[model samples]
Target chain A: MIGQGVLNMNTISDKVMFYRGALVPMAATFAYSILVMIYVIIRSSLTIYGSMPKGERSLILWLNGFSVAYSVMIFSLIMAMVSSLVGAVTALILKKVLLHFNPQFQWNKVLIISFTTALALLTIHYLLLRIFLNGYMTFDYPETFLFWWGFPAVIFLGVVVVGSYQFNKALLGQHLKGNSTSN
Target chain B: MKHIKRFVSYTLFFYATTALIYWIFIRPLHLSWGATFKEINKAMPADSLISPNRVVTTRAINIQAPRERAWPWIAQTGQNKGGFNSYHWLENLFGASMVNADSIVRQWQHPVPGDTIYYGKHQGYQTISLVKPNECYSLGGWSFYLHAIDSGNTRLIIRYPSMEVGQSRWTSIYYYGLFEPLHFIMESGMMMGIKHKAERQK
Candidate 1:
């Protein structure tokens, strides 16, 4: 449910990076955020099988469910909004350095920007969890940080890069003719 | 325009058929989610209001906090009190105007049996059937049981016994098709909401 779809190719101005730069990428990031929420919720849920007593597991589940009352996808919305803010700043910096005044949407440049935005999001999540989640002992695995953070980071990179790439093509009136060589 | 119309009709038909099949085939799993056979068959306090031949669904979740810490939250649940611990947005979309509380208000504690549990002006209300501090709580047709697995951990199990109205086809369709899913979503969210408050704080 992207708000508006199929904009006129002429309406989108080149060198501005309006939809190509922000909106589509934000949409993909939003999807990425939903995936992260699902992952976090599921991971928290799976801890029921850990060595912890069933009561503690219930507590974790209760907390996880409460997040659900944050209502099904609202957790994602919160995560998306925060990640988007971080991503917008990262994009601005990346644009100044790599995407400056380029009307031509280089595939490589888009990939690089997506990767960095995902990286920034991943870094923030890692720092926040590291600082706050030490005492409660919710996550038991040693690789909890890398696994949890890494999964979402990988998803963010994949979604934003591919979604932006395709949408940018439409934004700029470029057509992919079956094969990559033709395009 | 014609192509779009055909697509819409096809999608609606497919969804309706699929939903019915799911209700018939996969409904039991959802009804007994995370519950053992023993738990489902076991009698709990909420069974006082349960009618025979009605569909009974039991869902259980684990909590990190002990019953003592979790009891206040379970006690204060009501429309104008702690709220249902469901999606406030969904409730408000139906004009329920629920603002769920994050903290247990000292004033709202101490609910007793026979109290009418308000679910706002927009919803049908359930009366409080049972309330035992740090033990169990049941409101009308649903029951919430708190079992301490250990001193530090608690297992919260909720049983909801409900069924479709037999009066009319429309009522049956509405009950099984729409109401059941919505109840599941809301109730499941409530379970999580309680768990979240208990574990997140202490």
Candidate 2:
């Protein structure tokens, strides 16, 4: 028992700490998905609106936006789900391996693990993009695509590191408070 | 022995990463950067001059501008003109003197057939063999074609119908190892640059 009870006891906070390793990236995906949704609707609708007669442009834009939204919503949702799921799975695996070494969480290790995992996942994501949703990326070259998306991934990597670090810190705090780390 | 082992490890790591990066990213793009099947196979005006024989490389982009709007950017592509509309920094790093224009200049809006297009001292030059205003601009073995998808959008295709043909084995290695990748990077940059300029105010 590292805390109030056995970490093996499967308590609510323990589960939250275990699974919610994915929470930050999940939140990021939700946020980025909405931005992508709005951007697509605006950009696609505007291009279509240009083909319309002046009198019907406003109506055309509105209708086109709706249709485009109907089409892209599924893609946007799927991307978010994929990102969150990947992040969650990565965190779960890493945390399990780390926790196996000891019941207490180490802050420095958590940060390093989270950041490296984000980079690896993003690289794989870029490659998998060629096989799926390549059109959605729109950039003619992968370098250009990476240049645009890499900054955001780096930003999220920071968030993930901080989030993972905090969660591990809390677990460590609990362990320290309990005055015992023996499993 | 420890020092020798460390040196060997570093060398192996370097080579491993270079090979990994080449296979994963560089090789695929150099093969056919962003070309669609239809775009790659579609016979172009350049085909008459170059002929797609051994190794064909076709790349294209969807420009969110009318064919008319995007044509001027393509028209102005030459060293003495508006430049190749590519990565000026990279090009200049190789003594290309590339200065990609941001706006369509009136004088450069048209190119007469038989004009020479410079790819700088590094990549040699091409001769303009055909010009069809907002339709096709052919420079001997290379060309750019615009297909209007709608009033507001165009499919800009860059076709080098014959990238290479039956050459010596050593030349083939040079083309694959060096020339193809460098060309892909510059060409892709040019496509994006054209798209960026054409899409402006469009």
Candidate 3:
């Protein structure tokens, strides 16, 4: 009975740790996704305004602003689902690769490393965006600073995603080689 | 390699299809809802213009003061008095700064017809179009567009077509629907501010 109780406690602790590791990325993605949606909305509105006559521009501008807000809400819901699915699939694949490469390679350490790295990259991307946007939004016409501000974030995310994929593959390969020789 | 290629293709297909659907269906659906600018404009009278898109608000005041009396206050428009001047909320968002009230108020004590007022990185050249001494005044000025466009130079023209009379239904409706507390702040609140100042002088 005591052993069963201990096992239950272990499961609970693992869940708690998993949740803790996941929380920051979830929040970051949600916030960044909203920002991206807002940017898209504003950009769309500006386009509408640009196309309209001078007298009618403001009407379209306001319309675009409200539309963007609505889009952001929808995006947040979709982003949450995508993030969880992607995160879980990634973690599972990494675990499998580690097991195949070296039977004794630590899984927990790799997860912690990946989670922390992703979190750091997200933070840096947001900071760089804030710097480039200056003080105005895309809704403010002729204020194209926001585009420059946010473009770097996309580049950074691309780099991180590709680099992590390569690094994970290399780590799994080394682990597999080390374990096969030992056995 | 085949699996990797498949994954890439699938991701690209999903994203492209989703984007295409959004552009074709969702965008048009939103535009059709009268929630769009074109639709809203069709709803409005031909002469009316709504500045901010989503919200509606506006205000106006009638004063028994001539154009000369009102010109000073209009030229030095600020937040406390209901002008975009000193609207700190807008400073960060739109790069607008309200003129110094002290200088504006002092300089505006008795503005005649043609006076130039200065604010940060911008200028206001005031002109009195019509004036009935101590009765009514129309105040207008050359104000550059808030956007950084070099389209000659834009202007803000406020016409006070009444002395203690309400605005036309058309003006009221557009202002109420589009401008909001800002329209109220500028037309009514600022007008009241001008009236108080001008009346005090009288």
Candidate 4:
């Protein structure tokens, strides 16, 4: 009966593993994007109002401003979705790579692998930004690139990796307790 | 259904965590550039641009050159004058026919208050509001200051103030969201250009 129970728990864990690996990172990326969007809007708004001259305070001006903000928000939302998908794929790839090395999951190994994956993703992102938004992401604003893109990518990867690990551990722990109780 | 709920909960957690990290670590760093708490809060001559309820941005850089060496670069910044030592291509894209000077031009070095400094052909001009040779100057709403930290180093400070012309929240959002980031990139490049010029001259 104990052997049967262990097998049952393993099956359940196997079923949930894919979901945990993919969804957790996706959700984290989406959330981070939303937070950044809000921040950018607020900061940008204060800057605009401060700079506008007294003569330019017309209804048409305000409308134009709102239209621009609305357009940017739309663009950001699309990018956020793309980033979420990328993050999910990265998490899944990391899990597969780690499993190839060791069947048993190790927190230290997970951290190391995830960090490397994050760095690789950051390089890809930087290249993409350079190719597309060359004007905005030029070498002149090295600090901006580091702060705006690099820092956030690191934090996102760290949070998703650790969060998913803790969550899976908790789920396994609960299943074990349930089996013991039933016995 | 359960999976969807879990995903939503985890997303909220990540959002809160990321937001907290940015607020605590990143926002403060971006808001003020190389300025101490006292220096950022201190009233500047540019404060007169928008006396009350004004928004001010302060950015500073440490130049290896003396105040005098950096002063010439600042003095000749305008559309027709020695163009703001920033990216000429980028400035040109914004309708500016800028040719950044590699060395100091003796003719453009002497700028007095009330003199007009054009930004671009059709964009606008900033009238020189204040001038203190090798020390400080204010043009329209922006003020530039040079402090001699020692014989070899100078702290270049710039203060930009804009009046809050009672607009709806939407106006502020638009300005910051679309225009401000672009402006920051150009301005930051300009600052680096000045530093590069000053250091090379030294």
Each model's total of backbone clashes: 15, 0, 13, 4
Off by over 4 Å in 1: A1-183, B13-21, B24-26, B164-167
Q: Candidate 3 docking: what grade?
A: incorrect
TM-score of each: 0.52, 0.49, 0.28, 0.48
lDDT of 4 by residue, A118-181 (tens): 6776788778877987654433344444445755677666765675466445544655677788
TM-score leaderboard ranking? 1, 2, 4, 3
Off by over 4 Å in 3: A1-183, B1-72, B78-86, B99-104, B117-202
- Residue B2 lDDT in candidate 4: 61
Winner on DockQ (2 vs 4): 4
Q: In candidate 4 chain B, where is summed lDDT lowest over 10 consecutive residues?
A: B22-31
Docking class of 2: incorrect
Give a tens-digit lDDT track for model 3, residues A51-145: 33466455434434544444444444455565545444444443344334433334454455555555565576467646885453333422333
- Write one digit per residue (lDDT tens) for candidate 4, span B48-107: 765566666777767888989999999999988999886565456444667788889999
DockQ of each: 0.02, 0.01, 0.04, 0.04
* Candidate that beats the other on lDDT, 2 or 4, i.e. the better one: 2
Could you tell me how far off, in angstroms, the CA of residue B191 lies in candidate 4 after the best superposition?
1.6
Candidate 1 chain B lowest-lDDT run of ten: B1-10
True contacts kept of each: 0.00, 0.00, 0.01, 0.04
Looking at model 4, residue A1 earns an lDDT score of 24
Q: Residues B38-66, candidate 1, lDDT per residue (tens digit)?
A: 88889887686888777778988778888
lDDT of 2 by residue, B1-202 (tens): 2443454345345445554656565565545555777777877766878754757688876887898888898898897789987656545544555677777899888698988788864457877889999999988867888999998889888877544688889787666554665566567667766776777754
In model 2, which residue pairs have backbone atoms overlapping below 3 Å? Answer: none
